[model samples]
Target: MKQPTTDISSQQAEQLLQPINQFLQCRTPASWIEQAKQPQSLPILLKDHMVCELKAAQSAMLLIRRYAVDEDSGNALLQWLKPYEDFTYRLKGNWRDLADHNKLNKRMVPKSTKPYSQELIDKMVLLIKEELHHFYQVLEIAAELGVSYDRITSSRYARGLFTHVRTYEPAALVDKLICGAYIEARSCERFAAIAPHLAPNLGQFYFSLLRSEARHYQDYLSLAQQISDTDINPRVQFFAEAERALIESPDSDFKFHSGAPV
Candidate 1:
């Protein structure tokens, strides 16, 4: 196959992804990219990718509602997400139905006067919007390829990272944000790693996502720092090592974010 010229060169990609690569413990194995490029992987990849995007938005919504927004704003946030979640979780609607309602209902109001609260709401709301748009784009790609949106079980990739989260107030939130950074970073890394090997249309789509995903990681890291009373380096290193293991280790099943094949 003639590869598309849309890909960033390795050096450029490396430079673009360096901040993320430095934060992660291990690089994705070339074997995973090889496997991901095969004809058989498209359906599951798109399906899980769609889910991941929606999950990203949902996670951002949760963060805002829990730590930033007031009760009414939180409720408004949920209402904003309902249609997308309903389509994803309940199979209640299609991409066009979602397309009809593209805007969030209202801006979130901070639950407190804390400096970080409004910052969190602003950054996360934009993140949520971008994520939902990405979700819709993935669905469009799947539809174009005649792939059905089958519900696959969640990958261990996210669960493994979440398990290490501390179970207390600011620590818990800090850890969660760190995990979010790792997740977004990994996604950006994988997008760059695999884009060159995909079909032209898919390659273009994946390439288009690199910038937003990179920003998402940076935003997560910044938010974590802003919310933390102390340096989060130790916590960041902990999650980096953990996420590295999750990516580099053998896995029994293939997933959008799964480790190298066994």
Candidate 2:
């Protein structure tokens, strides 16, 4: 396969990362990138990345089902996701079969007349579709590179943010969305940060994803603001700091979005 051009300069990368960087409380440490860039790390990195992509889609699907859709529609959403979820969680299916399921229809619809519900449904559905496709692409890349699939433990990144979520209507949903924003933003930042450290083909692929990832962060933040009746900035800040702590702290295990080297 021909390598795609990844001629991104340091200045350009920082420019692209600036909005996300400013929004985030901390940067991915140099040591983490150093650890990730090693040839031995590619398999686990790609595996975790593939999982992360699927998880992003799953998270978005869950958000739409839980907050935006009717009971019947939520069931439909679960049915739509069942094939992919089975592949990831159960390891019972192959990623290639998702070719038929990737194109989404109107199976999931909003339950309420609340304007934000449909808006969220629309945005998150699109996100789910894109993320699932990215997951498939990652799998194909792994196959080409001869990397076998094995389930790995999730990093502390997401759980740390989840621990801070307030357990109340709209507040819980709002906090989840804010957390989603931070996750997406950090993913985008890390893609840029690590791209130059990877081989040409892989670096190019990661760099190519920056645009969609940036938009994903914006979509999550927009939905959070639209869903809440009150200012969501405070909650946003809360997760920003929480996310920073997760990234800056020492981690015993290394995975994508892992913290500082121990």
Candidate 3:
């Protein structure tokens, strides 16, 4: 079960972030922190963050759709995401209207879990719900901050991690889950690293996100371990190194998960 988000003190934040910090290969680089906290950066920050929340929801949906769910369940999942996609992609919907569409209209019935387990569906379904909720919260904050939503190009961080995934069955899924773990872990690290520098409410909002995202990291790791037929230590190490390089190296792009600014 997941823990609820509540007000957390600096000391509590430190305690919450301890495991995430250790799991990540390195801290958010000082350069990135400086860049992120600038007055002009908030819109871009919220814009990209809003986009990312939607993307995270999409990713989790696709995971269960491809590997776990039946046709009706998969279609329902797509419908759940449609409003946000329309707002972002087609610019055809109101943000306020999106709140009405953030739930699964019907039950998500899983199909045969051959390459994966029921836990994958269980964890990912919860993840999809939370990520979509976060998407809505980001829209609320962006609206309050007077930041309008616009599409932005994705950073190399996720694609760079995916480039190394094995093409084989179960291994591919396992690798993807490991990648998910690292992504969630890095998000927790970055939110902790940057929250204090944001506006009070925004900082608190970011802190509130830490609990769920940390659980997401753990869930992804657990699913990866469950799916792997072999000991996943070496594979986990492999992605850890890959993830470290992505976090620590310099990059020209600046997204939430981008490397140090070049």
In candidate 3, stretches whose alpha carbon ends up further than 4 angstroms from where it belongs are: 1-5, 113-116
Instruction: Judging by TM-score against the true structure, name the best candidate.
Output: 3
| Per-model TM against the reference | 0.93, 0.93, 0.95
Candidate 1 runs further than 4 Å off = 1-14
Give the Å error, residue 20, model 3. 1.2
* Cα lDDT, model 2, residue 151: 76
CA shift at 2, candidate 1, in angstroms? 18
Residue lDDT tens for model 3, 19-120: 887777678899999999998988887878888788888888888988888899889889889999999888887899988887787877777646463677
Q: Write the per-residue lDDT of candidate 2 for residues 194-228, one digit (tens) a residue.
A: 98888778888888778778889999998889889
lDDT of 1 by residue, 13-91 (tens): 6677888777778888987888898889988899999999989989999999889988989988888888888888888
TM-score-best of 2 and 3: 3
The parts of candidate 2 lying over 4 Å away from their true place are: 1-15
lDDT of each: 0.85, 0.85, 0.85
Model 3 lDDT vs. the true structure? 0.85
